[model samples]
Target: MTGPTELPVPDTVDVRSGPEVSDQLLSLLPLLGEWHGEGVMTGTAAGSAQDVRFGQWMRFSHDGRGFLAYESRTWRLTDEGRIVGPDVRETGFWRPRGDDDVELLTASPEGLVEIYVGRARTTTSWELTSDVVARTPDAADVTRAVRLYGLVEGALMYAIDRAGADDPLRPTMSARLERLR
Candidate 1:
């Protein structure tokens, strides 16, 4: 059997910072596209003997709505840049509140959900802090997290700082991704 030909209101995948998107989403429009790149992770953070690398694909889409849909998937890479295995996957939404306030809701298949709130620091930069982090019984221990995303030199670059119950917040992972669209 075949499924339907299309969604009733299919998501639009290639909207730039224009009037098509909600006014609240203007500050986030630059991120609306597919991004791919590789980055290094601390040994301790990667649960490995030493620092490791990973490749990631991230996307931001919209349906001419008030929020943006977000998703990210990553895979582990070898020293020679070959895929080893899966690393992380996340799905979420970005809700721009009022004019400048932003709220990000994200979840991982590993059973962790995080709610973040912040504001656009610049036309191309955003800083978010974790307001809540909930996990299942088997999930990893996460106490706090912060993220900074910036459009730097024509690339989408981001860094995450995280901490556990017993650990202090520190830089964890960062990547410079180029838009594929």
Candidate 2:
């Protein structure tokens, strides 16, 4: 005898037809989808010495649970709009506490793991400050970070500010992505 191959409780991008989303996650309802867009990346992070254009795809999905699984992948784009190669990739989860607080846990390919806690500023906006920025022995000297995500008009907009060993917090990346479906 064999069991089903499909996930017992699969994550769903289509909220209307997915396992009834828990009311606990309703505060984050607007962010349920896959988004793709281009954004500018600039900083002192090695390859980011100059302003670089990057394309990003982010998904926020739930599996009939209280948290939403998240993933983001970005690729570098030449000024001429050519895809050079991959840039940064990360995956994590978003959990809402009660009615207003939120927690985001993410792990990056660069050996960094972040735990951010914040709250819903409005029905369409959230601001998070890192409670911890842990990294492996070879990771960048990231000390702390903050991120803000919002829905403007019909687009998903986000920005991240980070501080390293001797670096002050500054804008690292910001983007506006459109829902694919």
Q: Extract clashing residue pairs from model 2.
A: none
Query: Where in model 2 is the C-alpha error above 4 Å?
Result: 1-6
Q: Using Cα atoms with residue i matched to residue i, what is each candidate's TM-score against the true structure?
A: 0.94, 0.94
Clashes of 2: 0
Best by lDDT: 2
**lDDT of each residue in 1-181, candidate 1, tens digit only:** 9888887676866764433777777888888889999888878778888888999999998888889999999999999999999998899999998777889999999999999999999889999999999999988788899999999999999998889899999888888899887
Candidate 1 lDDT: 0.89
Which runs of model 1 end up more than 4 angstroms from their true locations? 16-19
Residues 1-181, candidate 2: write the lDDT tens digits.
Answer: 9888887667898887769899999889899999999998875653556888889999999988899899999998999989999998999999999789999999998999999999999999999999999999999889999999999999999998899989999888899999996
Window of ten residues with lowest summed lDDT in model 2: 40-49
